[model samples]
Target: MIQAMYKRTKIGCEVLIQQAIDECPISTIKLYISRYYKKNNQRWALWARQHSPLLLQVTSTNSLESYHSELKRTTSSHYGLIGACHKVVALDQKQRTDSEYVAFEFRTKKISVMGLDDEILNEFHKFPYPIQRMLADEICAVENRIEKGKAIPGLTSLHCNCLFFIRYLLPCHHIFHEQIYGPTKLLTTNSWRNFQLMFEESGFEVYFHNELIEVDILEQTKAEKAAEN
Candidate 1:
């Protein structure tokens, strides 16, 4: 129950914690919940307002720490300054290439919704490609449930009861199920779309700036050589 609570947003956590307080049989568990969760709830719980869409899938900082470890590994006693610099550049390029490839695949590849019922799949198709992939994953994870409630009306007022949709602003399995009953527009304000937009807007500027700098440096070097001659 505690672990489940940790995965929920602050509002959801409060609801679950209250349920635990009212129904939990174990005295020690109730005591711990009352003391730690009830008294100092906001300090520990992940509030929806504070959460970032990019980090909704992230559980810990271990991945970042691992990347730092790998970066440190690129430099050692065996490597000179130039060798370390070259290795760093190579690693950076490889990472950038991998990122571009992934983005390209995301943009180009057709998402298969083979198992989904025709109605549901048709609604799913109305979304953008990135959203389709995300919804597909969510739909696969949905278990059997007697769905209750009406579909939300519009993008501005859209919401899903599930934590993923609440925290990340992506439609969850429940929302998709709701969509079957009544169609709702999928909003595209989440981090994934933002990243795609940002890249599309700024990707060329860096290369253009770099080429200009290189040309200026070459011109300066040539002028210095001519003066010496």
Candidate 2:
């Protein structure tokens, strides 16, 4: 079962079953295919799932350490579910306050522009400071990366197949290359259509002053104000 789970195609599963179990391999593989996979391609199969070989690059144990430690310190083992819920709400409020402070600082003290393309950098600056910082670092990585064989997922939109893009869902080196070298157009709110959006519609306000991104705040604010009410 363990080895069969790795098989992506029906044929692949049958071959594995044949190698392992000499009898009724065909029937066994047919049953396995029917039960194990949804569409036979979207399982824990090695090729289907996007993952990086570097463990630390994708996820880190230390990333949640601060939140875990704070939660642990605030909540006792003896607390009931309701008490624990209250502790979590308090902790969340504290973290949100800290985040708002950092965001305010980022807005007032604009981050240093690291990338060369003024067009993209202009868009990058509008996002929250944390997102701006993240994108700036990505641009630097792209600038230094040897682009001989960048794993471009597609050029239809700003998307890449690289581990970096897969992990962050941000513009990767390949997408940057498209804008810099290829015939790809400039960035805009509708840049990613039929794909994952980088930010919410409310976050689009950050692009207000950017000449390249033609976002209409006049129309947006009406709905935003209504939603808040």
Candidate 3:
């Protein structure tokens, strides 16, 4: 879907993508706006449609031949059909979630994630290109119901979503805090106990004393047994 959207936008257009943070020549980035007339109005939104440029590129003779061939090849391949259905569902869920979250981030810039690590940090950097391109393309694609006549929504949302998903959501859901946060997010038993003690001393109610006592006892028992040996 990303590839198709990209191709559709790039087929007969020139899109300007932002330089990566490291590659950025200047500290401040200037915005680019589209100036096409009808592109500025969403009044004709019903006429706007996304289509496969690949389909348009195929020669008429070969295209019809391929279409007929594909139609002729259709069979009761139940397993393949089921797999295709699953793929569609997965893709739909992904696209829906992506668009929703992107839209959300567009509205709000701040997002939080719990876990972080080197692996996730690396992957976060990698997925931005196509993401930025798609966003840039979308911004240029939609000129109706939008002001400033540019892809600022796409640009800002894409960057924020990339940062939020990579730094927060992925870490919270997938990576271990130990890997990402290293020593910061981790709490040793002693540290936790100390924190609880401080909380209690400060008149904050905490209910994990029993669990902490068990941990303390287990630690003491292990130390005593090792010393005796």
Candidate 4:
């Protein structure tokens, strides 16, 4: 008889298993889901269950410091250190005060503000909530319209190229005009770009203004033709 010697050792490897539920116990919480299937020759009733994790697997190493640091990188180039600092201060002020408007302007040269007064009054009927709600809704609506290839109506200017401040801090227009502007020019493109670059370098994303182009329902232009093709 031959003698055998064995040594224990730890081993690990990632494995993907088929019909994964077989490896684990199902919870008693029975959920009903609707599924549709095509009809085939044989008449049969089938029951199948599947489990999908709702929350993604999160590794909790990243922190706020890392995030802010990333943002600082993008913004520093566009806005100098001082201008960037001012924007941060202005943003904080806006958040605290809760009165701010974004830079928006009419895309069409001939566009008239005929219904603007009524819209403004109707939307901001309440003392505090209306204005807030209007801003929130308008932002969402404009984003949606842009995504859906629809026209975004009405535009408001952001004093100067202070789009960075508006995008980041969401300050009220009154404070921006009174506090931020200087010597006729409120903010310049270079200043805004630098500030925006700093934010970008610091790991923040910039959302530029929406493109102003009307889609003709009746006429199919060359650009539209190429897209369809």
Candidate 5:
């Protein structure tokens, strides 16, 4: 119950904790809850609301650190200034090419809908790309009400109760299930289109002015000295 409470919104969390305080059987549980969670529980759970949207599938920075480590392995302290510059330029070019390739794939490839029913697939297209991706990745069944045993009917009510959906304004996996089984439909929004455009335009060089004039000057000076010798 405590862990579940942590997953809820700030006000929802407070309400649940208050309920727990009122009904908990053990005095020590009540005392601990009052001391730790009553005052500023929001601070602990704020990241779920703030970072979950941007995080997507990543839950930690370990992958980023691992990439940095791999990059370090590819570079060497023994390389001269020109060699280092060339290496950096080569790596940058490779990354740019890879990014362009990914953008191309995203533009060209159709999302697979082999198993989804015709109705579900039609409804899926109504959602933005991010929401669609989220639904595809985290597929699940619609949750039943504990008291009623009836499935939730639509995305709006599910979105209201779901912390992830509310925080990000993206459909949660549960809502995806609701869409599949019920009359729930994800509405089209400018946010997804804007996001797609932003991603497609990322790393595109708007202006390319050469900034290696100092290196050019040094090379010119060396050439002159060599000619004189």
Candidate 6:
């Protein structure tokens, strides 16, 4: 339970730990939980797992360390400033290109597993590029959701307590099972555009330019008040 809690969100971790702590028959285990796990629990959040250009699917610094080592292996101290800069940029470019290639392959490939029919794949394919990209992660996790059984009004109700939805504010695999109800809007809206798709895909410096249009968004959404008319 303790080991599994590492992948769970902050609230999920707390709930699991509290249950185990209360039900534990061994005083030593309970003490261990309270003293160690509870004390430094903040560090265990899914914080580091959120994907970014620099970190690319990393759960920790291992990949970053490995990347740095690769950089050292590829370039030499004798290369001096100019040569080293060229090698470093080349390596960075290759890495980003490889990432893009893999993403493209996945997007084009027809997913065949987890009981997904060709028709369903077709439905997913009909969404625009950005919306499809937003759904990619959710689609990959559909099997896992099937294994766990689809969530029922999870956490606060509309969305699951999983890290993906919390981080992106789009439909997680759980709620996405009902995509027929329409979730593409969330992926395209200015409020979520900055996050729904992977950010900093082409560069390292990150910034959001979406906050300036809240008034426009409100006006665009005023149609929701149709009944008031």
Highest lDDT scorer: 1
Regions of model 6 farther than 4 Å from truth: 1-40, 47-66, 78-83, 99-115, 126-158, 176-229
Alpha carbon lDDT at 89, candidate 2: 96
Residue range 56-166, candidate 5, lDDT tens digits: 233468856865675677789998889878877877787779868876654454455556656545544544444455555545334333235765455555354555554
What's the candidate order when arranged by decreasing TM-score? 1, 5, 2, 6, 3, 4
Alpha carbon lDDT at 197, candidate 4? 47
Model 3 weakest 10-residue run by lDDT? 166-175
Candidate 2's residue-wise lDDT over 154-228, tens digit each?
387655656566545567666765656566653455663312233444343323322223469987898799999
For residues 1-229, could you state the per-residue lDDT of candidate 3 as single tens digits? Answer: 1222222233222222222223445544322222332233222121122222222222147744764454445433564877766655665576579778865544334222234333333333332332333323332333332344422222211122222222211222111223222334333434334432432332211222211112587889999999999
Whole-model lDDT per candidate: 0.59, 0.59, 0.34, 0.32, 0.56, 0.57
Q: Looking at candidate 4, what is the lDDT of residue 38?
A: 15
Clash count for candidate 1 is 0
Report how far off residue 34 is in candidate 6 (Å): 9.8
Q: What's model 3's lDDT at 192?
A: 32
Lowest lDDT 10-residue stretch of candidate 4: 1-10
Candidate 1 lDDT over residue span 1-229, tens digit each: 5553354566677777788788988999899989987777666555532344443444468956875687787777799989988988887887789878877665456678767876555545544466567778887755343344434333333465566664445567665554444455343335335423433544323223221112587889999999999
Question: By TM-score, how accurate is candidate 3?
Answer: 0.17
In candidate 3, the residue pairs with backbone N, CA or C atoms under 3 Å apart (3 or more residues apart, or in different chains) clash, namely 42-144, 113-168, 116-180, 117-180
Candidate 2's error at 3, in angstroms? 20
Leading candidate by TM-score = 1
Reference-based TM-score of each model = 0.52, 0.43, 0.17, 0.16, 0.49, 0.43
Could you tell me how far off, in angstroms, the CA of residue 188 lies in candidate 2 after the best superposition?
5.7
| Candidate 6 lDDT over residue span 1-229, tens digit each | 6453455456677777778789899999999988877667665544333332222223468767977988989998799899999999999998899879866765455433355555545555544344455566676676666678664333333455565565444567766554433333232234333442443353212322221123576765787677577
Please list the residue runs of candidate 2 whose C-alpha ends up more than 4 Å from where it truly belongs after superposition. 1-64, 67-97, 103-109, 147-156, 186-229
Query: Cα lDDT for residue 155, model 1?
Result: 37
TM-score of 2: 0.43
By lDDT: ranked, best first? 1, 2, 6, 5, 3, 4
